[model samples]
Target: MAGHKIPHFQNDAGHSAIEIGVKEFMCVGANPPFDHPHEFLDMGAETEKVCPYCSTLYKFNPALAETETVPAGCTLTTEAA
Candidate 1:
């Protein structure tokens, strides 16, 4: 059996909802063609924050173990703009 790898960054599809670690990352406005600029957001402080551009909801799930990666319903599909 093999262990799944966790990527440093991913797209908005699987990123719509997430539970992140202490690392700092950015959020882009749109999905692809209509995407906007990237804005860095910190998850260490709040439980959730909405993207000003795309209006997607982002959440922090503290229940997940550090060894775990992306949340359920997420695919690690795309990257930032």
Candidate 2:
């Protein structure tokens, strides 16, 4: 994730689980200000993982793009400094 754009996602809808396209990404808990610490998560050989801070389960979906997330609009488009 160091020289690349590791997709950042948020659980704005407060969904219990989210289906994501990539196996590696970041969970921001929610939007800025109120958002928790940005955490990097990897599923490795698994299909799902839960964010340690937010406890939001992320399921892998091969059909979706790296920037895509189920329920839509969950992908944080702007980069955090």
Q: Write the per-residue lDDT of candidate 2 for residues 1-81, one digit (tens) a residue.
A: 556678889998899999999998889998766599888899999999999998999999999998888888899863532
Q: What is the Cα-based lDDT of residue 32 in candidate 1?
A: 65
Q: How many pairs collide in each candidate, listed in order?
A: 1, 0
Candidate 2 has its poorest 10 consecutive residues by lDDT at 72-81
Give all candidates' CA lDDT scores. Answer: 0.49, 0.87
Give per-residue CA lDDT, model 1, range 1-81, as digits (tens): 125333233344635655554234455543567556765555556777666666655665556543333554332333332
The TM-score of candidate 2 is: 0.88
* Predicted model with the maximum TM-score: 2
RMSD of each: 7.4, 2.2
lDDT of 2 at 55: 91
Alpha carbon deviation, residue 12, candidate 1 (Å): 5.4
Please give the lDDT score for candidate 1: 0.49
